[model samples]
Target: MIQVDRLTKRYGSFKAVDGITFSVGRGEIVGLLGPNGAGKTTTMRVLTTFLGPTSGRATLAGHDVLDEPLEVRRRVGYLPENVPLYLEMRVREYLLYRAKLKDVPRSRRRAAIHEVITRCRLGDVEDRILGHLSKGFRQRVGLAEAMVHDPDILILDEPTAGLDPIQIREVRALIRELGDRHTILLSTHIMSEVEAVCGRVIIIAKGKIAVDDRLDRLRSESSIVLEARGPADAIRRGLESVPGVEHVVQAKVEGDYAAFEIHTKNGSDLREELAQRVLQNGWPLRQLDIRRTTLEDRFIQAVTRETISAEAEREAV
Candidate 1:
Protein backbone atom coordinates (compact mmCIF):
# COMPACT_ATOMS: atom_id res chain seq x y z
CA MET A 1 0.00 0.00 0.00
CA ILE A 2 1.15 3.57 -0.70
CA GLN A 3 -0.23 7.01 0.19
CA VAL A 4 0.68 10.43 -1.18
CA ASP A 5 -0.87 13.48 0.44
CA ARG A 6 -0.87 17.00 -0.95
CA LEU A 7 2.50 16.21 -2.51
CA THR A 8 4.09 19.28 -4.13
CA LYS A 9 7.39 19.54 -5.93
CA ARG A 10 8.86 22.78 -7.28
CA TYR A 11 11.90 23.84 -9.30
CA GLY A 12 12.50 27.58 -8.96
CA SER A 13 9.24 29.19 -10.15
CA PHE A 14 7.88 26.06 -11.80
CA LYS A 15 6.07 23.18 -10.09
CA ALA A 16 6.64 19.63 -11.30
CA VAL A 17 3.95 18.06 -9.11
CA ASP A 18 1.27 20.22 -7.57
CA GLY A 19 -0.63 19.14 -4.47
CA ILE A 20 -1.49 15.67 -5.69
CA THR A 21 -2.94 12.93 -3.50
CA PHE A 22 -3.73 9.28 -4.17
CA SER A 23 -3.39 5.81 -2.67
CA VAL A 24 -2.43 2.38 -3.99
CA GLY A 25 -3.58 -0.79 -2.29
CA ARG A 26 -1.50 -3.90 -1.68
CA GLY A 27 -1.20 -6.01 -4.83
CA GLU A 28 -3.26 -3.45 -6.78
CA ILE A 29 -1.98 -2.27 -10.15
CA VAL A 30 -2.60 1.45 -10.77
CA GLY A 31 -1.40 3.38 -13.82
CA LEU A 32 -0.05 6.92 -14.05
CA LEU A 33 -1.33 7.86 -17.51
CA GLY A 34 -0.27 11.17 -19.06
CA PRO A 35 1.64 12.86 -21.85
CA ASN A 36 5.23 14.11 -21.75
CA GLY A 37 5.91 17.02 -19.29
CA ALA A 38 2.93 15.84 -17.22
CA GLY A 39 5.22 15.42 -14.18
CA LYS A 40 4.56 11.67 -13.77
CA THR A 41 8.24 10.82 -13.47
CA THR A 42 8.84 13.66 -11.03
CA THR A 43 6.01 12.39 -8.84
CA MET A 44 7.38 8.84 -9.00
CA ARG A 45 10.83 10.15 -8.01
CA VAL A 46 9.33 11.78 -4.95
CA LEU A 47 7.51 8.57 -4.02
CA THR A 48 10.74 6.59 -4.20
CA THR A 49 12.63 9.22 -2.21
CA PHE A 50 14.95 9.96 -5.15
CA LEU A 51 13.81 13.59 -4.92
CA GLY A 52 12.39 15.44 -1.95
CA PRO A 53 9.04 17.15 -2.33
CA THR A 54 8.78 20.91 -1.98
CA SER A 55 5.89 20.27 0.42
CA GLY A 56 3.69 17.45 1.74
CA ARG A 57 4.58 13.77 2.07
CA ALA A 58 4.66 10.36 0.36
CA THR A 59 4.79 7.12 2.29
CA LEU A 60 5.23 3.75 0.63
CA ALA A 61 3.78 0.71 2.38
CA GLY A 62 3.49 2.97 5.50
CA HIS A 63 7.17 4.09 5.66
CA ASP A 64 7.56 7.83 5.27
CA VAL A 65 9.52 8.44 2.05
CA LEU A 66 11.44 11.31 3.61
CA ASP A 67 11.74 10.07 7.19
CA GLU A 68 12.71 6.50 6.35
CA PRO A 69 14.26 6.74 2.93
CA LEU A 70 16.23 3.51 3.19
CA GLU A 71 13.19 1.53 4.33
CA VAL A 72 11.07 2.96 1.52
CA ARG A 73 13.77 2.09 -0.98
CA ARG A 74 13.91 -1.44 0.36
CA ARG A 75 10.18 -1.98 -0.07
CA VAL A 76 9.86 -0.31 -3.48
CA GLY A 77 11.23 -1.45 -6.84
CA TYR A 78 11.57 1.46 -9.27
CA LEU A 79 12.26 1.09 -12.99
CA PRO A 80 12.84 4.67 -14.05
CA GLU A 81 11.60 5.94 -17.45
CA ASN A 82 15.12 5.71 -18.80
CA VAL A 83 16.26 2.48 -17.20
CA PRO A 84 19.86 2.64 -15.98
CA LEU A 85 21.63 -0.44 -17.23
CA TYR A 86 25.26 -1.56 -17.30
CA LEU A 87 25.68 -3.10 -20.76
CA GLU A 88 29.29 -4.20 -20.35
CA MET A 89 28.35 -7.02 -17.98
CA ARG A 90 26.63 -10.28 -18.86
CA VAL A 91 22.86 -10.29 -18.37
CA ARG A 92 23.07 -12.49 -15.32
CA GLU A 93 26.19 -10.76 -14.07
CA TYR A 94 24.58 -7.32 -14.24
CA LEU A 95 21.50 -8.49 -12.37
CA LEU A 96 23.58 -10.23 -9.69
CA TYR A 97 25.58 -7.04 -9.27
CA ARG A 98 22.40 -5.00 -8.87
CA ALA A 99 20.98 -7.58 -6.47
CA LYS A 100 23.94 -6.92 -4.21
CA LEU A 101 23.66 -3.18 -4.71
CA LYS A 102 20.04 -3.31 -3.58
CA ASP A 103 21.26 -5.16 -0.48
CA VAL A 104 19.62 -8.48 -1.26
CA PRO A 105 21.63 -10.04 1.57
CA ARG A 106 24.77 -11.88 0.47
CA SER A 107 23.18 -15.12 1.63
CA ARG A 108 20.15 -14.63 -0.64
CA ARG A 109 21.85 -12.86 -3.56
CA ARG A 110 22.31 -15.99 -5.69
CA ALA A 111 18.70 -17.10 -5.39
CA ALA A 112 17.44 -13.53 -5.73
CA ILE A 113 19.37 -13.11 -8.98
CA HIS A 114 17.98 -16.38 -10.29
CA GLU A 115 14.43 -15.50 -9.16
CA VAL A 116 14.35 -12.24 -11.09
CA ILE A 117 16.14 -13.65 -14.12
CA THR A 118 13.46 -16.30 -14.45
CA ARG A 119 10.63 -13.96 -13.48
CA CYS A 120 11.63 -11.50 -16.18
CA ARG A 121 12.13 -14.35 -18.73
CA LEU A 122 15.82 -13.58 -19.24
CA GLY A 123 16.90 -17.18 -19.85
CA ASP A 124 18.35 -16.95 -23.38
CA VAL A 125 20.41 -13.87 -22.60
CA GLU A 126 21.30 -14.80 -19.04
CA ASP A 127 24.86 -15.63 -20.03
CA ARG A 128 25.02 -13.27 -23.02
CA ILE A 129 26.66 -9.87 -22.58
CA LEU A 130 24.13 -7.14 -21.84
CA GLY A 131 25.52 -5.00 -24.69
CA HIS A 132 24.94 -7.86 -27.13
CA LEU A 133 21.30 -8.36 -26.18
CA SER A 134 18.47 -6.87 -28.21
CA LYS A 135 16.40 -3.94 -26.98
CA GLY A 136 13.81 -6.38 -25.63
CA PHE A 137 16.48 -8.33 -23.76
CA ARG A 138 17.98 -5.17 -22.33
CA GLN A 139 14.55 -4.19 -21.06
CA ARG A 140 14.24 -7.59 -19.38
CA VAL A 141 17.57 -7.05 -17.69
CA GLY A 142 16.41 -3.67 -16.43
CA LEU A 143 13.23 -5.26 -15.08
CA ALA A 144 15.25 -8.06 -13.50
CA GLU A 145 17.36 -5.45 -11.75
CA ALA A 146 14.21 -3.83 -10.31
CA MET A 147 13.00 -7.18 -8.94
CA VAL A 148 16.42 -8.13 -7.52
CA HIS A 149 15.45 -6.95 -4.06
CA ASP A 150 12.14 -8.87 -3.89
CA PRO A 151 10.32 -5.65 -3.13
CA ASP A 152 6.55 -5.64 -2.55
CA ILE A 153 5.84 -2.43 -4.49
CA LEU A 154 6.85 -2.14 -8.18
CA ILE A 155 6.91 1.33 -9.75
CA LEU A 156 7.69 0.88 -13.44
CA ASP A 157 8.03 3.97 -15.67
CA GLU A 158 7.36 3.15 -19.33
CA PRO A 159 8.62 -0.41 -18.93
CA THR A 160 7.30 -1.35 -22.33
CA ALA A 161 8.48 1.69 -24.26
CA GLY A 162 10.09 1.01 -27.67
CA LEU A 163 9.17 -2.68 -27.65
CA ASP A 164 7.66 -4.22 -30.76
CA PRO A 165 4.15 -5.68 -30.69
CA ILE A 166 5.25 -9.16 -29.65
CA GLN A 167 7.81 -7.83 -27.20
CA ILE A 168 5.25 -5.48 -25.71
CA ARG A 169 2.83 -8.38 -25.09
CA GLU A 170 5.57 -10.37 -23.41
CA VAL A 171 6.52 -7.45 -21.17
CA ARG A 172 2.88 -6.73 -20.41
CA ALA A 173 2.34 -10.38 -19.47
CA LEU A 174 5.31 -10.15 -17.14
CA ILE A 175 3.89 -7.01 -15.49
CA ARG A 176 0.51 -8.68 -15.00
CA GLU A 177 2.17 -11.75 -13.50
CA LEU A 178 4.08 -9.52 -11.09
CA GLY A 179 0.91 -7.62 -10.26
CA ASP A 180 -0.60 -10.76 -8.76
CA ARG A 181 1.92 -10.47 -5.92
CA HIS A 182 3.05 -6.84 -5.85
CA THR A 183 1.41 -3.46 -5.48
CA ILE A 184 2.06 -1.71 -8.80
CA LEU A 185 2.11 1.95 -9.90
CA LEU A 186 2.68 1.89 -13.66
CA SER A 187 3.67 5.14 -15.40
CA THR A 188 3.57 5.35 -19.19
CA HIS A 189 2.69 7.64 -22.09
CA ILE A 190 1.61 4.75 -24.33
CA MET A 191 -2.17 4.48 -24.11
CA SER A 192 -2.37 0.92 -25.37
CA GLU A 193 0.26 -0.26 -22.95
CA VAL A 194 -1.67 1.19 -20.03
CA GLU A 195 -4.90 -0.34 -21.33
CA ALA A 196 -3.22 -3.72 -21.66
CA VAL A 197 -1.58 -3.76 -18.22
CA CYS A 198 -3.23 -1.38 -15.79
CA GLY A 199 -6.48 -1.85 -13.85
CA ARG A 200 -6.89 1.78 -12.75
CA VAL A 201 -5.60 5.02 -14.27
CA ILE A 202 -4.46 8.38 -12.86
CA ILE A 203 -4.21 11.31 -15.24
CA ILE A 204 -1.76 14.09 -14.51
CA ALA A 205 -1.47 17.38 -16.36
CA LYS A 206 0.34 20.66 -15.69
CA GLY A 207 2.03 19.29 -12.58
CA LYS A 208 -1.24 18.33 -10.90
CA ILE A 209 -3.57 15.38 -10.59
CA ALA A 210 -6.41 15.96 -13.04
CA VAL A 211 -8.42 12.78 -12.54
CA ASP A 212 -7.96 9.41 -10.87
CA ASP A 213 -10.48 6.65 -11.46
CA ARG A 214 -10.99 3.05 -12.48
CA LEU A 215 -10.46 2.53 -16.22
CA ASP A 216 -14.04 1.30 -16.57
CA ARG A 217 -15.37 4.44 -14.87
CA LEU A 218 -13.47 6.78 -17.18
CA ARG A 219 -14.84 5.13 -20.33
CA SER A 220 -18.32 5.39 -18.91
CA GLU A 221 -17.92 9.17 -19.17
CA SER A 222 -17.15 9.20 -22.91
CA SER A 223 -19.54 9.67 -25.83
CA ILE A 224 -21.38 6.63 -27.20
CA VAL A 225 -20.77 5.59 -30.80
CA LEU A 226 -23.55 3.71 -32.54
CA GLU A 227 -24.32 2.39 -35.99
CA ALA A 228 -27.77 1.75 -37.47
CA ARG A 229 -28.99 0.97 -40.98
CA GLY A 230 -32.51 2.32 -41.23
CA PRO A 231 -34.54 5.22 -42.54
CA ALA A 232 -32.37 8.05 -41.29
CA ASP A 233 -35.20 10.39 -40.39
CA ALA A 234 -37.16 7.84 -38.31
CA ILE A 235 -34.00 6.56 -36.59
CA ARG A 236 -32.89 10.06 -35.70
CA ARG A 237 -36.32 11.11 -34.42
CA GLY A 238 -36.76 8.00 -32.23
CA LEU A 239 -33.20 8.38 -30.84
CA GLU A 240 -33.71 12.05 -30.11
CA SER A 241 -36.81 11.30 -28.04
CA VAL A 242 -34.78 9.19 -25.57
CA PRO A 243 -34.04 11.11 -22.36
CA GLY A 244 -30.32 11.53 -21.52
CA VAL A 245 -29.57 11.37 -25.25
CA GLU A 246 -28.15 14.86 -25.66
CA HIS A 247 -27.16 14.77 -29.32
CA VAL A 248 -27.03 12.36 -32.25
CA VAL A 249 -25.07 12.72 -35.44
CA GLN A 250 -24.66 10.67 -38.60
CA ALA A 251 -21.12 9.32 -38.26
CA LYS A 252 -20.80 7.48 -41.57
CA VAL A 253 -22.52 7.02 -44.91
CA GLU A 254 -22.54 3.76 -46.88
CA GLY A 255 -24.97 3.93 -49.82
CA ASP A 256 -28.56 3.43 -48.51
CA TYR A 257 -27.24 2.64 -44.98
CA ALA A 258 -25.84 5.09 -42.44
CA ALA A 259 -23.87 5.14 -39.16
CA PHE A 260 -25.16 7.20 -36.27
CA GLU A 261 -23.46 8.15 -33.00
CA ILE A 262 -25.40 9.18 -29.91
CA HIS A 263 -23.71 11.22 -27.23
CA THR A 264 -25.26 10.16 -23.95
CA LYS A 265 -24.29 10.18 -20.28
CA ASN A 266 -20.69 8.90 -20.06
CA GLY A 267 -21.21 6.79 -23.18
CA SER A 268 -23.82 4.72 -21.41
CA ASP A 269 -25.27 1.68 -23.17
CA LEU A 270 -28.46 2.77 -24.93
CA ARG A 271 -28.86 -0.03 -27.43
CA GLU A 272 -31.78 -1.74 -25.68
CA GLU A 273 -33.78 1.46 -25.47
CA LEU A 274 -32.68 2.33 -28.98
CA ALA A 275 -33.81 -1.07 -30.21
CA GLN A 276 -37.23 -0.65 -28.61
CA ARG A 277 -37.54 2.86 -29.97
CA VAL A 278 -36.61 1.82 -33.52
CA LEU A 279 -39.09 -1.10 -33.36
CA GLN A 280 -41.96 1.10 -32.17
CA ASN A 281 -41.14 3.66 -34.82
CA GLY A 282 -41.22 0.89 -37.49
CA TRP A 283 -37.66 1.68 -38.62
CA PRO A 284 -35.76 -1.57 -39.27
CA LEU A 285 -32.66 -1.47 -37.03
CA ARG A 286 -29.43 -2.75 -38.60
CA GLN A 287 -27.05 -1.83 -35.79
CA LEU A 288 -27.86 -0.35 -32.41
CA ASP A 289 -24.77 -0.47 -30.20
CA ILE A 290 -22.52 1.40 -27.84
CA ARG A 291 -18.82 1.04 -28.41
CA ARG A 292 -16.89 1.09 -25.15
CA THR A 293 -14.53 4.00 -25.38
CA THR A 294 -10.96 2.81 -25.15
CA LEU A 295 -8.45 4.04 -22.60
CA GLU A 296 -6.89 6.11 -25.38
CA ASP A 297 -10.15 7.96 -26.07
CA ARG A 298 -10.83 8.50 -22.38
CA PHE A 299 -7.28 9.71 -21.75
CA ILE A 300 -7.33 12.17 -24.64
CA GLN A 301 -10.77 13.48 -23.72
CA ALA A 302 -10.12 13.80 -19.97
CA VAL A 303 -6.62 15.28 -20.22
CA THR A 304 -7.57 17.63 -23.04
CA ARG A 305 -10.56 18.90 -21.05
CA GLU A 306 -8.32 19.55 -18.03
CA THR A 307 -5.68 21.34 -20.12
CA ILE A 308 -8.32 23.48 -21.82
CA SER A 309 -9.91 24.35 -18.49
CA ALA A 310 -6.55 25.37 -17.04
CA GLU A 311 -5.68 27.45 -20.10
CA ALA A 312 -9.03 29.17 -19.99
CA GLU A 313 -8.45 30.17 -16.35
CA ARG A 314 -5.11 31.78 -17.23
CA GLU A 315 -6.61 33.53 -20.27
CA ALA A 316 -9.43 34.90 -18.15
CA VAL A 317 -6.89 36.85 -16.03
Candidate 2:
Protein backbone atom coordinates (compact mmCIF):
# COMPACT_ATOMS: atom_id res chain seq x y z
CA MET A 1 0.00 0.00 0.00
CA ILE A 2 3.08 2.23 -0.30
CA GLN A 3 4.86 3.26 -3.49
CA VAL A 4 8.07 5.31 -3.87
CA ASP A 5 9.62 6.04 -7.25
CA ARG A 6 13.09 7.54 -7.68
CA LEU A 7 12.69 9.28 -4.29
CA THR A 8 15.42 11.69 -3.30
CA LYS A 9 15.77 13.86 -0.19
CA ARG A 10 18.52 16.41 0.21
CA TYR A 11 19.79 18.98 2.74
CA GLY A 12 21.80 21.70 1.04
CA SER A 13 24.21 19.72 -1.18
CA PHE A 14 24.11 16.45 0.82
CA LYS A 15 21.69 13.80 -0.30
CA ALA A 16 20.26 11.60 2.43
CA VAL A 17 18.14 9.49 0.05
CA ASP A 18 19.19 9.27 -3.57
CA GLY A 19 17.01 7.99 -6.37
CA ILE A 20 15.75 4.94 -4.39
CA THR A 21 12.53 3.23 -5.43
CA PHE A 22 10.51 0.41 -3.83
CA SER A 23 7.01 -0.57 -2.73
CA VAL A 24 5.24 -2.38 0.11
CA GLY A 25 2.04 -4.25 -0.68
CA ARG A 26 -0.92 -4.34 1.67
CA GLY A 27 -0.35 -6.39 4.84
CA GLU A 28 3.34 -6.85 3.98
CA ILE A 29 6.00 -6.39 6.68
CA VAL A 30 9.21 -5.14 5.07
CA GLY A 31 12.41 -4.32 6.94
CA LEU A 32 14.43 -1.26 5.90
CA LEU A 33 18.03 -1.91 7.01
CA GLY A 34 21.26 0.02 6.71
CA PRO A 35 24.23 1.35 8.66
CA ASN A 36 24.30 4.75 10.42
CA GLY A 37 23.51 7.80 8.22
CA ALA A 38 22.41 5.53 5.36
CA GLY A 39 19.09 7.38 4.79
CA LYS A 40 16.77 4.85 6.42
CA THR A 41 15.24 7.45 8.75
CA THR A 42 15.14 9.98 5.96
CA THR A 43 13.16 7.65 3.78
CA MET A 44 10.66 6.94 6.57
CA ARG A 45 10.24 10.64 7.32
CA VAL A 46 9.47 11.34 3.70
CA LEU A 47 6.90 8.57 3.55
CA THR A 48 5.22 9.73 6.77
CA THR A 49 4.91 13.31 5.42
CA PHE A 50 7.10 14.65 8.22
CA LEU A 51 9.66 15.61 5.59
CA GLY A 52 9.06 16.30 1.91
CA PRO A 53 11.23 14.76 -0.78
CA THR A 54 13.45 17.04 -2.77
CA SER A 55 12.51 15.14 -5.95
CA GLY A 56 10.61 12.07 -7.12
CA ARG A 57 7.21 10.90 -5.86
CA ALA A 58 5.71 8.73 -3.10
CA THR A 59 2.16 7.64 -2.44
CA LEU A 60 0.48 5.85 0.44
CA ALA A 61 -2.67 3.88 -0.20
CA GLY A 62 -3.00 5.70 -3.55
CA HIS A 63 -2.61 9.19 -1.98
CA ASP A 64 0.34 11.27 -3.12
CA VAL A 65 2.62 12.14 -0.21
CA LEU A 66 3.27 15.65 -1.53
CA ASP A 67 0.03 16.69 -3.21
CA GLU A 68 -2.29 14.91 -0.80
CA PRO A 69 -0.28 14.98 2.42
CA LEU A 70 -3.36 15.17 4.66
CA GLU A 71 -4.82 12.04 3.09
CA VAL A 72 -1.45 10.30 3.38
CA ARG A 73 -1.25 11.20 7.06
CA ARG A 74 -4.68 9.78 7.65
CA ARG A 75 -3.49 6.38 6.38
CA VAL A 76 -0.04 6.28 7.99
CA GLY A 77 0.96 5.94 11.64
CA TYR A 78 4.55 6.85 12.40
CA LEU A 79 6.64 5.92 15.43
CA PRO A 80 9.91 7.76 15.07
CA GLU A 81 13.23 6.69 16.64
CA ASN A 82 12.83 9.17 19.50
CA VAL A 83 9.12 9.05 20.19
CA PRO A 84 7.53 12.38 21.04
CA LEU A 85 5.49 11.98 24.20
CA TYR A 86 4.04 14.01 27.04
CA LEU A 87 5.77 12.59 30.09
CA GLU A 88 3.45 14.40 32.49
CA MET A 89 0.29 12.77 31.15
CA ARG A 90 -0.95 9.33 32.16
CA VAL A 91 -0.72 6.51 29.58
CA ARG A 92 -4.43 6.37 28.79
CA GLU A 93 -4.69 10.15 29.02
CA TYR A 94 -1.81 10.53 26.57
CA LEU A 95 -3.39 8.13 24.10
CA LEU A 96 -6.75 9.88 24.42
CA TYR A 97 -5.11 13.17 23.64
CA ARG A 98 -3.31 11.67 20.64
CA ALA A 99 -6.56 10.22 19.32
CA LYS A 100 -8.16 13.63 19.45
CA LEU A 101 -5.17 15.19 17.71
CA LYS A 102 -5.35 12.57 14.95
CA ASP A 103 -9.03 13.55 14.48
CA VAL A 104 -10.60 10.46 16.01
CA PRO A 105 -14.31 11.31 16.37
CA ARG A 106 -15.36 12.35 19.85
CA SER A 107 -17.68 9.33 20.01
CA ARG A 108 -15.03 6.81 18.84
CA ARG A 109 -11.99 8.32 20.55
CA ARG A 110 -12.64 6.45 23.77
CA ALA A 111 -12.98 3.10 22.01
CA ALA A 112 -9.90 3.68 19.86
CA ILE A 113 -7.80 4.64 22.87
CA HIS A 114 -9.00 1.62 24.81
CA GLU A 115 -8.34 -0.79 21.98
CA VAL A 116 -4.78 0.42 21.43
CA ILE A 117 -4.11 0.33 25.15
CA THR A 118 -5.24 -3.29 25.29
CA ARG A 119 -3.33 -4.28 22.15
CA CYS A 120 -0.16 -2.53 23.32
CA ARG A 121 -0.34 -4.26 26.74
CA LEU A 122 -0.90 -1.02 28.66
CA GLY A 123 -3.92 -2.25 30.58
CA ASP A 124 -2.05 -2.42 33.88
CA VAL A 125 -0.28 0.91 33.40
CA GLU A 126 -3.00 2.81 31.58
CA ASP A 127 -3.51 5.02 34.61
CA ARG A 128 0.20 5.44 35.35
CA ILE A 129 2.06 8.57 34.29
CA LEU A 130 4.09 8.21 31.11
CA GLY A 131 7.27 9.52 32.77
CA HIS A 132 6.87 7.06 35.66
CA LEU A 133 6.70 4.08 33.28
CA SER A 134 9.79 2.04 32.47
CA LYS A 135 11.58 2.33 29.15
CA GLY A 136 9.68 -0.66 27.82
CA PHE A 137 6.32 0.63 28.93
CA ARG A 138 7.08 4.07 27.57
CA GLN A 139 7.79 2.41 24.22
CA ARG A 140 4.46 0.65 24.42
CA VAL A 141 2.82 3.99 25.11
CA GLY A 142 4.44 5.40 21.97
CA LEU A 143 3.15 2.49 19.94
CA ALA A 144 -0.34 2.98 21.37
CA GLU A 145 -0.26 6.63 20.40
CA ALA A 146 0.67 5.72 16.84
CA MET A 147 -2.23 3.25 16.53
CA VAL A 148 -4.77 5.38 18.35
CA HIS A 149 -6.27 6.44 15.04
CA ASP A 150 -6.18 2.96 13.50
CA PRO A 151 -4.12 3.90 10.47
CA ASP A 152 -3.68 1.44 7.60
CA ILE A 153 0.13 1.71 7.47
CA LEU A 154 2.68 1.73 10.33
CA ILE A 155 6.09 3.32 9.78
CA LEU A 156 8.26 2.45 12.77
CA ASP A 157 11.87 3.59 13.15
CA GLU A 158 13.84 1.63 15.79
CA PRO A 159 10.84 0.22 17.63
CA THR A 160 13.16 -1.84 19.84
CA ALA A 161 16.04 0.53 20.17
CA GLY A 162 16.87 0.79 23.89
CA LEU A 163 14.88 -2.08 25.41
CA ASP A 164 16.46 -5.13 27.07
CA PRO A 165 16.37 -8.60 25.50
CA ILE A 166 13.00 -9.49 27.05
CA GLN A 167 11.45 -6.21 26.04
CA ILE A 168 12.88 -6.55 22.54
CA ARG A 169 11.26 -9.96 22.18
CA GLU A 170 7.96 -8.55 23.37
CA VAL A 171 8.11 -5.70 20.85
CA ARG A 172 9.07 -8.07 18.03
CA ALA A 173 6.12 -10.31 18.80
CA LEU A 174 3.80 -7.31 18.87
CA ILE A 175 5.08 -6.11 15.49
CA ARG A 176 4.54 -9.59 14.07
CA GLU A 177 0.98 -9.55 15.34
CA LEU A 178 0.35 -6.09 13.91
CA GLY A 179 1.59 -7.22 10.47
CA ASP A 180 -1.59 -9.25 10.05
CA ARG A 181 -3.65 -6.05 9.99
CA HIS A 182 -1.32 -3.30 8.77
CA THR A 183 1.23 -2.74 6.06
CA ILE A 184 4.48 -2.13 8.02
CA LEU A 185 7.77 -0.56 6.98
CA LEU A 186 10.26 -0.98 9.84
CA SER A 187 13.79 0.37 10.30
CA THR A 188 16.23 -1.11 12.80
CA HIS A 189 19.85 -2.13 13.31
CA ILE A 190 18.97 -5.66 14.47
CA MET A 191 19.23 -8.30 11.76
CA SER A 192 17.62 -10.97 13.90
CA GLU A 193 14.53 -8.81 14.31
CA VAL A 194 14.13 -8.68 10.53
CA GLU A 195 14.75 -12.41 10.28
CA ALA A 196 12.12 -13.00 12.94
CA VAL A 197 9.26 -10.73 11.82
CA CYS A 198 9.94 -9.57 8.25
CA GLY A 199 9.15 -11.65 5.17
CA ARG A 200 11.17 -9.33 2.91
CA VAL A 201 14.21 -7.09 3.39
CA ILE A 202 15.29 -3.92 1.59
CA ILE A 203 18.87 -2.99 2.41
CA ILE A 204 20.07 0.54 1.70
CA ALA A 205 23.67 1.74 1.48
CA LYS A 206 25.22 5.09 0.56
CA GLY A 207 21.82 6.67 -0.02
CA LYS A 208 20.82 4.03 -2.59
CA ILE A 209 18.92 0.75 -2.73
CA ALA A 210 21.48 -2.05 -2.52
CA VAL A 211 19.48 -5.24 -2.12
CA ASP A 212 15.78 -6.04 -2.07
CA ASP A 213 14.68 -9.69 -1.83
CA ARG A 214 12.69 -12.22 0.15
CA LEU A 215 14.32 -13.41 3.36
CA ASP A 216 14.07 -17.08 2.40
CA ARG A 217 15.60 -16.47 -1.02
CA LEU A 218 18.51 -14.51 0.44
CA ARG A 219 19.13 -17.26 3.01
CA SER A 220 19.00 -19.90 0.25
CA GLU A 221 22.31 -18.62 -1.12
CA SER A 222 25.05 -20.89 0.28
CA SER A 223 28.74 -21.82 0.21
CA ILE A 224 30.78 -24.86 1.17
CA VAL A 225 33.39 -25.06 3.94
CA LEU A 226 36.16 -27.65 3.71
CA GLU A 227 38.96 -28.59 6.08
CA ALA A 228 41.40 -31.44 5.39
CA ARG A 229 44.97 -32.57 5.84
CA GLY A 230 47.56 -33.55 3.19
CA PRO A 231 48.96 -30.74 1.02
CA ALA A 232 47.34 -27.33 1.11
CA ASP A 233 48.17 -26.50 -2.50
CA ALA A 234 46.91 -29.86 -3.77
CA ILE A 235 43.64 -29.54 -1.82
CA ARG A 236 43.14 -26.02 -3.13
CA ARG A 237 43.80 -27.11 -6.72
CA GLY A 238 41.48 -30.11 -6.37
CA LEU A 239 38.66 -27.93 -4.99
CA GLU A 240 39.17 -25.30 -7.72
CA SER A 241 38.88 -28.01 -10.41
CA VAL A 242 35.51 -29.22 -9.08
CA PRO A 243 32.56 -28.23 -11.25
CA GLY A 244 30.46 -25.30 -9.91
CA VAL A 245 33.26 -24.15 -7.62
CA GLU A 246 33.58 -20.40 -8.07
CA HIS A 247 36.47 -19.44 -5.78
CA VAL A 248 38.58 -21.24 -3.16
CA VAL A 249 40.13 -19.06 -0.51
CA GLN A 250 42.24 -20.41 2.35
CA ALA A 251 40.54 -19.46 5.62
CA LYS A 252 43.20 -20.47 8.11
CA VAL A 253 45.80 -23.11 8.96
CA GLU A 254 46.40 -25.03 12.16
CA GLY A 255 49.53 -27.18 11.97
CA ASP A 256 49.00 -29.63 9.04
CA TYR A 257 45.22 -29.03 8.66
CA ALA A 258 43.95 -26.09 6.64
CA ALA A 259 40.45 -24.60 6.29
CA PHE A 260 39.19 -23.29 2.97
CA GLU A 261 35.83 -21.68 2.20
CA ILE A 262 34.53 -22.71 -1.22
CA HIS A 263 32.31 -20.17 -2.92
CA THR A 264 30.14 -21.84 -5.56
CA LYS A 265 28.20 -20.63 -8.56
CA ASN A 266 24.38 -20.57 -8.42
CA GLY A 267 24.39 -21.42 -4.72
CA SER A 268 25.50 -24.96 -5.55
CA ASP A 269 26.38 -27.57 -2.90
CA LEU A 270 29.60 -29.40 -3.77
CA ARG A 271 30.34 -31.13 -0.46
CA GLU A 272 30.15 -34.64 -1.93
CA GLU A 273 32.42 -33.85 -4.87
CA LEU A 274 34.94 -32.04 -2.63
CA ALA A 275 34.91 -34.97 -0.20
CA GLN A 276 35.51 -37.46 -3.01
CA ARG A 277 38.36 -35.38 -4.33
CA VAL A 278 39.93 -35.31 -0.87
CA LEU A 279 39.54 -39.12 -0.57
CA GLN A 280 41.09 -39.72 -4.02
CA ASN A 281 44.08 -37.54 -3.08
CA GLY A 282 44.65 -39.52 0.15
CA TRP A 283 43.83 -36.52 2.38
CA PRO A 284 42.34 -36.99 5.86
CA LEU A 285 39.08 -35.08 5.75
CA ARG A 286 38.25 -33.30 8.97
CA GLN A 287 35.24 -31.19 8.05
CA LEU A 288 32.85 -30.76 5.12
CA ASP A 289 29.72 -28.66 5.46
CA ILE A 290 27.43 -26.22 3.70
CA ARG A 291 27.36 -22.76 5.26
CA ARG A 292 24.13 -21.01 4.53
CA THR A 293 24.17 -17.27 3.87
CA THR A 294 22.71 -15.14 6.65
CA LEU A 295 20.95 -11.76 6.61
CA GLU A 296 23.96 -10.14 8.25
CA ASP A 297 26.25 -11.57 5.59
CA ARG A 298 24.10 -10.15 2.82
CA PHE A 299 23.87 -6.80 4.59
CA ILE A 300 27.63 -6.49 5.02
CA GLN A 301 28.28 -7.65 1.47
CA ALA A 302 25.88 -5.05 0.04
CA VAL A 303 27.27 -2.18 2.14
CA THR A 304 30.85 -3.20 1.34
CA ARG A 305 30.10 -3.39 -2.35
CA GLU A 306 28.59 0.11 -2.25
CA THR A 307 31.59 1.51 -0.40
CA ILE A 308 33.95 -0.08 -2.95
CA SER A 309 31.99 1.33 -5.85
CA ALA A 310 31.97 4.83 -4.32
CA GLU A 311 35.74 4.59 -3.86
CA ALA A 312 36.20 3.57 -7.47
CA GLU A 313 34.10 6.51 -8.67
CA ARG A 314 36.24 8.90 -6.64
CA GLU A 315 39.43 7.31 -7.95
CA ALA A 316 38.21 7.61 -11.53
CA VAL A 317 37.64 11.32 -11.05
Give the whole-model CA lDDT for all candidates, comma-separated: 0.84, 0.92
Worst 10 residues of 1 by lDDT: 219-228
The C-alpha local distance difference test score for the whole of candidate 2 amounts to 0.92
State TM-scores per candidate: 0.82, 0.91
Model 2 root-mean-square deviation: 2.3
TM-score (C-alpha, index-matched) for candidate 2: 0.91
Error of 1 at 232 (Å): 15
Q: Please list the residue runs of candidate 1 whose C-alpha ends up more than 4 Å from where it truly belongs after superposition.
A: 219-289
For each candidate, how many residue pairs have backbone atoms clashing (under 3 Å)? 2, 0
| Most lDDT-accurate candidate | 2
Per residue, candidate 1 scores C-alpha lDDT tens digits across 207-303 of 7787788976765665555556677776677788997788888778676676788888656677677777777866666766556667777777678
